[model samples]
Target: MEQRHKDLLRENRVFLIDNLIMKNFIDHVAELLTANMEDTIMSNATNHEQVGCFLNILERRGKGAYQKFIEALTDAECDHVRSHLEQLEDEDCVDGYDDIDGPIRQETGNDDVDLHVSDWMKTDLSEEQRQTPISERAMAFVAREAVGVMEVGKLMGFTEGRLRQFQASSPIPSSQISTMFSAWRSQKGKQATVENFVRLMRDAEVDEQHLKNVITREYPPGDAMA
Candidate 1:
């Protein structure tokens, strides 16, 4: 009887562990899909063939095939996938699944500067909008305005061909962008207003006298700028 009980416990543990791992994988994929679709919907040209190409590269790189699949998913698909996976995970937990490999991990592999914007902007992007790296996030801002590569390049003071090359190389994953946008929506940046700054300075008891003293000491006679 004891042996039977031990075997049953072992089976339960295996089941729980598998389910938990599956849940984490699904969540990671969802984020990938979100980032990919932050701007343009996946084109008809981007069928399974392109996805397969990415999967092949990822598998070769040992980054996980499932993750590449998620990155290839469309914005619309990601929303559904995220919901379904979340539901499945919740059900497993309710049924006593508790063996997570770790707390959720964020996807942070791709860092090509060209992919900074569209890669961080697209569908339902609350999280990306909030936590996207500044450089990447800035691109999305310009892209949303429909600023073409040439226009953006001009703004950045780069040549058009160079900008296009950058854009081509750093193709943004819609899933990642979507998740970032979700985060973005719920967050607010610090308002760099005069009133707010003054309020903060006052709260800290900083006044013109403090500023003048620091400036005078730092400048020291002829070193002061006009």
Candidate 2:
């Protein structure tokens, strides 16, 4: 998307989120935008997170998609969003970025995200809001809300053999998930972040329901969405 569009989306994100939550607009708008969002992503995500996904998808789909998206918003009586898109600056950005929108987003518009650890698991998210290594509070929220220990471990960079090894060794473990998290944190070192962790999970081709539940984590009340 143009930087103007990105800025528009960034500024009016809260209103659009509310609009999506209150109305039957998600599927309709997704159809218009050609995003084809998964059931898990739609069902388990919060209104705020859903809008994030929506905006990201819209941006990713680029020119062909944004017109449909804007038209849909206009149809939905989403004045805040419609007005912003319609009134965007004629000048386009060379790099096409918005400073406030630089967080490591959880939702993705890519294809074929694989599992297993890699140096590619670099983490740089929400520096505009929080640090990359995930603040303790954010980690706590992820650790608490997280389900599906084994899959999450894979997203966190664990291999199938290693998970089985742990299971075999610990036989009747009290908290396999917590233990997995500790290992992930230790391995990721400074890169262990809520954005990286959640994005990696959702970005995977698995499309597990767990990823949706993840980015919905509550940070401080009255965040940008609130």
Candidate 3:
């Protein structure tokens, strides 16, 4: 089996059985598959091969088949799923995770200054929130605050020019950025630099909570999604 399939099995084993919310998500996916298959048999059949790869992993876990999987769900399980789904849906609506309908915050403005490090530290933001992409201004600030763009890029195993391109056009992966940050900070007598870097990130509106979490070596909640 593919590593991705193995990972799915591992995640499903950990989350899907005991977690009603996950179970409901799987059920919803199954429902969507059924509906799509009803509409276009051949298309859905092709898709089913991909899904079948996932289901086969579950079957290996002693679930037998999809119908049996549905039959196995208890009333209490269904109730818990519905309750959790409703709560999540409500939160999603308020947060606009699906569709953010607002003006993008400018790089240098009062809006940028609004999200202070102290305010972020007080709230229990999820890993997803912390992992949100850093802005170019924030990346530039971090690069400046650290040893330098070239040094930081070397630490990240990327060329200085490539790192600059990433800062200008895209955010580096949070884990990679975090790892490089930590490694850069670990050099002897760099504690003050690290502190200054954190402040610079806060000033740049770079979601300093994640920087704090990384500097403190806090383990990600759950398995550090992506």
TM-score of each: 0.19, 0.35, 0.22
Instruction: For candidate 2, give the lDDT of residue 211.
Output: 33
TM-score: which candidate is best?
A: 2
- Per-residue lDDT of candidate 1, residues 16-113 (tens digit): 23323332233444432223232222332443333333222222121132334434333324554434444555565565543331112113333432
Compared with the true structure, the alpha-carbon lDDT of candidate 2 equals 0.49
| Regions of candidate 1 where Cα sits further than 4 Å from its true position | 1-46, 52-77, 102-226
**Per-residue alpha-carbon lDDT of candidate 3 for residues 127-164, written as tens digits (9 for 90 to 100):** 44344433333443333223223334453456676656
Model 2 lDDT per residue over 1-226, tens place? 3435566677767766766652356655644232124343475557677666766555543233556776777677776756754555332233443332222232431232333222122221133323345444444434433434454566667898877765565433324555666677778887776556656544332223333333334333234331
Global Cα lDDT for candidate 1 = 0.32
lDDT-sorted candidate list, best first: 2, 3, 1
Q: How much lDDT does each candidate structure score?
A: 0.32, 0.49, 0.40
